[model samples]
Target: MPRYDYRCRACGTNFEVSRPMSEASAPASCPDGHDDTVKLLSTVAVTGAARGGAPAPPPAGGGGCCGGGCCG
Candidate 1:
């Protein structure tokens, strides 16, 4: 199962739920009971390296005394 994020248009609430990918886009209601909810695209954070995309910003102080040149 994959986790999905949903937002309620009627009540302006946000929440996350884990469900099958086939049902990820189905109509989901707000936990508060509102029926006019919409699903939102998901996002994630990368820690050390980029996951098939552009590289992430170097940590504060440039990663170490070597100034991030070691990986290159």
Candidate 2:
């Protein structure tokens, strides 16, 4: 199951749901029973090891280390 983000057109509410790919395409109703919900395109962050078993480094400047650059 993939997690998807959705936005309610009627209420302008945003929510996340986990469902199958087939169900993802269909329109979903809001928890408030409004039939104006639309799925929003969202980006997911993924982190793991590489194919050669090497761990991936953290994102640049993510450590708050002077934007990943050493002091002059």
Candidate 3:
């Protein structure tokens, strides 16, 4: 199940609901039973490195303005 964030316009209350992706767009009621609720766009935070491996270094020799002294 995925969690979705919602806000109630009636009481200005924010809450979260867990449901299936199929019902992701379904209407949700607030804890105070407010029907005037809207689904909020939420940002997801990804943690940890993939496969327990460190991140790869940036590639070198890209002749950008910062690297090529064109901006200097």
Candidate 4:
């Protein structure tokens, strides 16, 4: 089931509903007993290097001047 976002036009309420994709077009009633509602365009934000977020963790193991390749 996917989550849907809705805003009650009658009471100005913001809410969400989880239902099958087939029912995505179905009407939704707000918890405030309002039948008039409209689906909202939700926004999702992801945090990572792609989104200019914090850097990734360093890799495990040890390294030297030549990366421990020629010295040892």
- The TM-score measured for candidate 2 stands at 0.62
Question: Cα RMSD (Å) per model?
Answer: 8.5, 5.2, 4.3, 12.2
Clashing pairs in 4: none
TM-score of each: 0.57, 0.62, 0.73, 0.60
What is the RMSD of candidate 1? 8.5
Q: After superposition, how far is residue 40 of candidate 3 from its true place, in Å?
A: 0.2
Q: What lDDT does model 3 reach?
A: 0.88
Could you tell me which 10 consecutive residues in candidate 1 have the lowest summed lDDT?
Answer: 63-72
**Poorest 10 consecutive residues of model 2 by lDDT?**
63-72
Q: TM-score for model 1? A: 0.57
Model 4 lDDT tens row, 22-62: 99999999999999999998788766673357676544444
In candidate 1, what are the lDDT values of residues 1-72, reduced to their tens digit? 788889999889998878898886677778998988778877887466577777877687568657676755
Q: Which scores greater on lDDT, model 3 or model 4?
A: 3
List clashing residue pairs in candidate 3: none
Candidate 3 ranges with C-alpha deviation above 4 Å: 53-72
| Total clashing pairs for each candidate | 0, 0, 0, 0
Model 1 residue 64 lDDT? 62
Candidate 2 residue lDDT tens string, 41-62: 8988887788799987667765
**Native-vs-model 2 lDDT?**
0.81
